[model samples]
Target: MSRDRQRLLDYLVHILEAIARIERYVDDLDEVGFLTDELTQDAVIRNLEIIGEASNNIDKYYPEFSAQHDHVPFASAYEMRNALAHGYFRVDLEVVWKTLEKDLPELGLSVDKLIRQLMDENSGL
Candidate 1:
């Protein structure tokens, strides 16, 4: 694998790990109840930051791959990451909750598919 591809794979691994952590943390909580706990909120936000960061790396290190997966929203993830990492008060917990509850599962699936695609490409090479 190219070094950039390997680094992209590393970032993807982090993204997947973060997604799994968020899943485990929020599996039992409802939306209203989810943001009420400080620990869960922090955990979720941190994982979100990780996802955004990974998305950014994928865009940077593997531009063609990122461009191919236009549905993944790499730019939006960077925007979200910037919000989470820089502007604490700007974060709408409800939005965060909604994202976790709705968007994350689909994101996970997309990212997993991306990993498989990369791996398949590497194997062929």
Candidate 2:
């Protein structure tokens, strides 16, 4: 595999790992208010940022990869990451919670699929 592709793959792996960690914390939440916990909030936002960065890098090498995956919200996800990373003081926890609940799992699945596709393609080559 090309170095670029390898780097993308590494980023994707990091994203997946971060997502798993965030999910572990989130899964323990019994009520909506649980999102108010500072640790949980921090972890979720950080993982989302990682996911976005990885997705963005992957898209850079394979623009069609984002469109092809269909499971991940590549552009919007990255935008959210930028907002969280750059505008943390102004970011709304409610929005972050909603995003975690609604979008994260889908994004994780999409990234996994993309990673597999890259692996398969590399093997074939």
Candidate 3:
């Protein structure tokens, strides 16, 4: 594989790892527990930041790939990262909880699929 493809694969792997970490961090926590546990909240938010950073890198370095895979919310993830990184006080835990509950699983699936597709394409090449 070319260096660019390898880098992109690294980013995808980082995203998947972050997602898994977030899942494990919140595995047993309800909304209330998540909100109340500052450590877990911090861990989750940090992983989210990682996801957004990886997404941003993918968009920057692999614009064509990002454009083609419009199903992945690369822009949105980066935007959310900006919000969390810049304005921690304004973060609404309720929304975070909702995102965790609803959006993350789907995001994980999409990213996993992308990783597999990328690997398969590389193998063919």
Question: Candidate 2 — worst ten consecutive residues by lDDT sum?
Answer: 28-37
What does the lDDT read for residue 107 in candidate 3?
A: 94
Q: Name the Cα RMSD for model 1.
A: 1.5
TM-score of each: 0.92, 0.82, 0.96
| Pairs that clash in candidate 1 | none
- Summarize candidate 3's per-residue lDDT along 1-125 as a digit string, tens digits: 78989999999999999999999999999999999999998898899999999999999999999999999999899998998899869988888889899989999999999999989999995
Candidate 1's TM-score reads: 0.92
Worst 10-residue stretch by lDDT in candidate 1?
72-81
Query: How many residue pairs clash in each candidate at the backbone level?
Result: 0, 0, 0
Error of 2 at 28 (Å): 0.5
Winner on TM-score between 1 and 2 is 1
Sum up the clashes in candidate 3.
0
Cα lDDT of all candidates, in order? 0.88, 0.78, 0.93
lDDT computed for candidate 2: 0.78
RMSD values, in order shown: 1.5, 2.2, 1.1
Quality of model 1 by C-alpha lDDT: 0.88
